[model samples]
Target: MLGPLQVRGKDGPLRVPPGRQEVILAALLLEANRVVGTNYLVDLIWEDNPPETARTQVQICVSRLRKLLAGADSTVSISTRPPGYVLHVDTGDVDSLLFTGLVAMARRQRDEGETEKAVALLKSAVALWQGDSLTGLVSGPLANKAHQLDEERLSAVELRMQLELELGRHDRLVGELQLLTHENPLRERLRGQLMCALYWSGRQAEALEAFRTGRRILDQELG
Candidate 1:
């Protein structure tokens, strides 16, 4: 559920029903195991101007999703509870959850002075991202959630590169860091890391220039 509204079963990928149904499933999966309230889901599906039949539409969407899951032979289940529903699936089954666990493990490894292991784990974690979270389905609450997840992904990348720099792999990291800083000019952490990588790579002038560029951007945009 990280990249798209994909629901894989024992056989293969299950075709998710279109429109509000997909939104409902995404909302449930995002809060998997926790019962999401009916009102909350209604807001997610229609933003602010839901129709009078919005609650009934939500119920119908849930019902369709359940049948789709059953048809696909998915281990995942949606159970109705007071106020709303809960998506029952293993945490590991969700890509974002798995990525988060890997990132946590990587951080632990890095804290333990195991730079190589940390780098490897972070690489695996970052690779799970096929694209932006919930791509092509941005609406309402999920859009904000997706943006938050993307920030986490960028942070993880920055952490991984920081570990690489600590290993004196500055020469190899300079190119990547430069591009990342260019893509996210306002990201102070990435800019700082890029400056460090350039300095350690024996490009002192380039490092100073990077700092100047970042400072200018910060002053211009933030002030």
Candidate 2:
């Protein structure tokens, strides 16, 4: 699940049901093709303060989601098994799984001495993320999962930038690295890449300035 929980129909994105229903749908989709226990769903949506009828509510939500998906002529479906539910969708339909798969393939390409192919694969992987992972959702575990996904995205970007630098694209990477560093000021690897891009482009003063700025930010943030 990237950005908002968007489910597309044949025409476009199907209108997702809002609030806790959306939360339930998201949780199921996150564990797509696998059984997610009703208990786990309740705990996730309510988190230490579930109502007495939480399980029933979860069942109801799932029923509504099944209807929504079916009515839209969507391929996605929810199945009821003992003690849990399963969202039966293709592996490629889930963005997070596809992202990791691409990243794994990209690593293989890098190992095979095909850096350009690796970078292209990574570009596609990162493109799957529309914005912050799981933006505007509640549930602490899902938020933590989102943070983990965001970190994965950053690592992929870091690897891609490293490969680009090795390919002698320093001059072209300067502006893009500047923007990335600005967006992620606390990321020292990105800061280091920005510095390298600047120095290799004959902007030594700016390179040093970038270091100084990063140092200040790290000290303030870490301390």
Candidate 3:
């Protein structure tokens, strides 16, 4: 579930029934293969104060989600345990998990000085993101989780560009780096990489300008 909440069967894209059921399914998917306690599920759905019927409503949501999954012929199954529910799904089926694994592999390749391989791996990892993670479901505790995943994605992109720069592809990276720095002005690593790219491309004046812009942004934002 990288972008919007999606469940696909062997045939095609499976339609996730809307409303609270969607939220319940998302919460379960986030912690697939583990039991998410009933209380935690309640908090995820209703936040601080849930109504007297919150537990019942949660059960209803889970039942509906199970039906939807079964109807879609999905291999995943939700098991009712003592405390709550567990969504049984393969790790490979989740885009976020695949992305994380790819990033980890890329990091290892980068450490081994395999710049080309690392760049390719990172490119594939970043491509898994269709849009903002958990879109339309970013509320409650999931907001922070989404933000963390987004930061990871940005780091992967920065690392990929850094590898490209190391391979003397600085000239080709200038435009992309410029846009990245503009989008994440306060990210020192990206700014530093941008400066290096600009300098290597013989754009010395622009490199100095980039540093100045970063320093000014840091002072304005942090001071």
Candidate 4:
């Protein structure tokens, strides 16, 4: 659900066969324990041009997934219910769902003036990401969802930075902000944050340069 799609068995990581099986499993995992219609999957995988055998092909993919999962931990599974299928697992079993839960809890903590606790929870949430969301599967139906997840991660990061800055931890934040701003140069909010961190840490020249760099990039690329 986060980064690459992986299944854990009693031993260790289970290898999911590549191709449609990977996509089907990803779709089912996205809607764990909820029915995902067969037609929707056909449209998602084939993308507006599906052969007549699409449904059968989907069924075959599901069968292969089931066989692969047979060796996986019992807590995860797939079940057919008419027009669709369901992937059964605890909410905590899914990294993305767990990340969402942590972020929500952190937001509640932040709203209640528990800024330290909020930052801690946000750290946990951010640590769940191994890399960009759905890195290999984003070209298909999961594109929008993957983008949304990435946005959620970014928001969590920014919120944590704000809280830490407010707590007067700007010294510790400068290095992190540098890396984030480097990775996401086009994100103006992150750039602003990096500038603030640099200024607060007494690197006033660097702060001004950060601002200048952003202005230059916006003028040259977006103008």
Top candidate by TM-score = 2
Q: How do the residues 115-218 of candidate 1 rate in per-residue lDDT, one tens digit apiece?
A: 99999999999899888888878475888999999999999999999899889999999989989998899999999999999998899999999999999999
Per-candidate TM-score against the hidden true structure: 0.92, 0.97, 0.93, 0.96
Q: Which stretches of candidate 3 lie over 4 Å from their true place?
A: none
Clashes of each: 0, 0, 0, 0
Number of the predicted model whose lDDT against the real structure is largest? 2
The lDDT values for all models are: 0.90, 0.91, 0.88, 0.87
Give the Cα error of residue 204 in candidate 3, in Å: 0.7
Give the 10-residue window scoring lowest on summed lDDT in candidate 4.
Answer: 133-142
RMSD of 3: 1.6
lDDT of 3 by residue, 1-223 (tens): 7788888887887877666777778888888899989888788778988999999999998998888789878998899997999999999998888999999999999899888999999999999988887788735687777778899999999889878988999899999998999988989999999999999989999999999999999999998
Better of 1 and 4 by lDDT: 1
lDDT tens readout by residue for model 4, 21-79? 88888888888889999998887788888999999999989987887788565568888
Sorted on lDDT, highest at the top, how do the candidates line up? Answer: 2, 1, 3, 4
Q: 1 or 2: which has the higher lDDT?
A: 2
All candidates in order of TM-score, best leading: 2, 4, 3, 1
Candidate 1 RMSD computed on C-alpha atoms after optimal superposition onto the true structure: 1.7
Q: Write out the backbone clash pairs for model 1.
A: none
